[model samples]
Target chain A: MNNTATYHKAIKAATSKLTDIRKFVAKHAREHGFNEKQISDIQLAVDEACTNIIKHAYQFDQTKNFRIELEFDGDQLSITLTDHGSGFDPNRYQRPDLKKQIEKKKRGGMGIFLIKNLMDDVSYSSNNNTNVLRMSKIRS
Target chain B: MKTFKIEHRNSDGFEIIDLYGELDAHTASQLEESLKNLISDQKSNIIVNFRELDYIASAGLGVFMAYIEDVRTIGGDIKLSNMNDKVYNVFDLLGFPTLYDIFDDEKQAIKKFLSDS
Candidate 1:
């Protein structure tokens, strides 16, 4: 994976940056051995993560921006989505247990759960005013 | 990415389209265009089958939202049936259960619409 991207403060956390990054991944993921199902799953995972950023990252001001990056080496893909607005404890984020929620028809927190299920690896870390979320999947 | 294949059948004042595959950002535009063309031809009372559909996204839901008002205003309706969990979750998230009539099968959806008419 190679690194690339520029960050700018633009319209809160809602920007086309995330979608562009996802499309970038989708395009490159195809070059690897990712099938349609795998691509769609990865797309959805990226979408959910972006949605979360827009919803929870910053204050409701339209003068902020977030950073998103995507990289792929022929065998695997990695995405690093970061927000400078705020940072939260990843350990405190409890994903909804599907087995328990299925019987109750519950909603909410499905984003992280789906992302975790689809991606082979997920990690979160905060450094110098940036909350970075990294997700990846290997072609198998 | 998802592709939609449609099968149309003419009934009394109704036209049913059996849709297959995912309805997401990559494919929602196709479905939207197809629906627009059919509507322009005055074919209404549409029922979309999701038996083979695996998923949908916000963009796909937006397409239905765009057409719902037009179809209903013209005294026609659009119904959905046989949605799997992944696809259904998208609809449920957008509050589709209150906006449109959804059923477990095509027959039930057709009958429900016909009876109302």
Candidate 2:
């Protein structure tokens, strides 16, 4: 059966929107028969992605907005987040050294780390107008 | 939108903050403020009770990371307890098990703080 489908939402680049974003993902993932653990993983990965965009790309500019697109099929789910401000550089991200972060009082790098760990595959790309972070998870 | 709340319970020498509802980037600041106040007040033997927290994002974890060292240096600790499997899984994925002390029960965490002091 061809069960492929797509969903999208455009949200303001503010911390307040994070709850709505998670709800949107959970509502659809449950409808698509994703298990609790799978839904949690996707929700967290997407949350981390959007949080990074709001903080880094738009710098908490509520006037700016971003888009989240999810497309899923029989055995996989994929999410793409697009922002219009300064895009993130994936190469600049080092694996967060937890002890050092604590010692140095750092708190920024863990979001990307969590996104990578929660999603099965993740990649990034950006143009003059758009920066995109794409992540995918396989249903187990 | 789901609401996030923090309720403080005073123990003999430390304090336990019970969290309710979802904790994400939006609600993380509230937790950050609570931790900050506790540290400034020198009430640092902190036990965060996650029994009612249905969800947590990396941002929530970041709040903990930002403050854990401060509390430890003040001769106290921010021990966590009663995390749901989902929340615990996130922490475990980030290798938090080795860095922070986690307890299956709130009493255990309290006991740990008391024993250390």
Candidate 3:
């Protein structure tokens, strides 16, 4: 079985909605014997995707709206967060090499790196001024 | 998600805590407060299980770091285990691996605490 959720991206607007999404997915998955660890992983991915949209997508403008979609399969969970903001090529953004960056204690760009590492798959794309970040994890 | 429920269990000179729900800007302070109270009460050697935690931010990580020095001063330590990759990645990015004892499971974390203590 599978389930899905869609939220409009607005600063702090959809923040509370995360709980609903987590419960919705967790409840369904639990019936099929998904463990607590697997459930937490899905919730974390959703939270990260939503937070990214809130923090980066509409950096300064609150008037704009974005969309986040989460879909879950029996063994895999996927979340696609879409933002229509100043589109930057993710390809140009370099991941800060930890061993090197830690010496200076610089922050930023950690979000992307964290999201990528947590999820089994992660990809970024910009089309028609919309930045879509897709993240997925397979339940083990 | 559900609000965090803290379960404190005492096992052989160690405190095992299960932290549930999301750990973000709004909820990070709660962790700090709980830890502060525990420290004031002189209950040290804490282990946090992130088995049910959904996410964490730098500010949330700040909560853990905030108490490390204080806990260490009292000859105690704070350890974490069972972090989903997403949460683990956040900790890894913050370089927590170098500063704290992080493990893949609760057993390992508990063992590390006992063996080191």
Instruction: Note the Cα lDDT for every prediction shown.
Output: 0.69, 0.88, 0.68
Question: Best candidate, TM-score-wise?
Answer: 2
Candidate 1 pairs with clashing backbones:
none
Docking class of 1: incorrect
Q: DockQ scores for all the models shown? A: 0.08, 0.82, 0.15
Candidate 2: what's its TM-score on chain B?
0.96
Q: In DockQ terms, which candidate is top?
A: 2
- Superposed on all Cα atoms, the candidates' RMSDs to the truth, in angstroms, are 8.5, 1.5, 6.3
Score every model by TM-score. Answer: 0.54, 0.95, 0.56
Each candidate's interface RMSD? 9.7, 1.0, 5.0
Scoring the B chain of model 1 against the true B chain gives a TM-score of 0.89
Locate the minimum summed-lDDT window of 10 residues in model 1 chain B: B20-29
Q: Flag the better candidate by DockQ, 1 or 3.
A: 3
Give the runs in model 1 whose Cα sits over 4 Å from its true position: A1-12, A15-19, A59-62, A95-107, B1-105, B109-117
**Rank by TM-score (best first):** 2, 3, 1
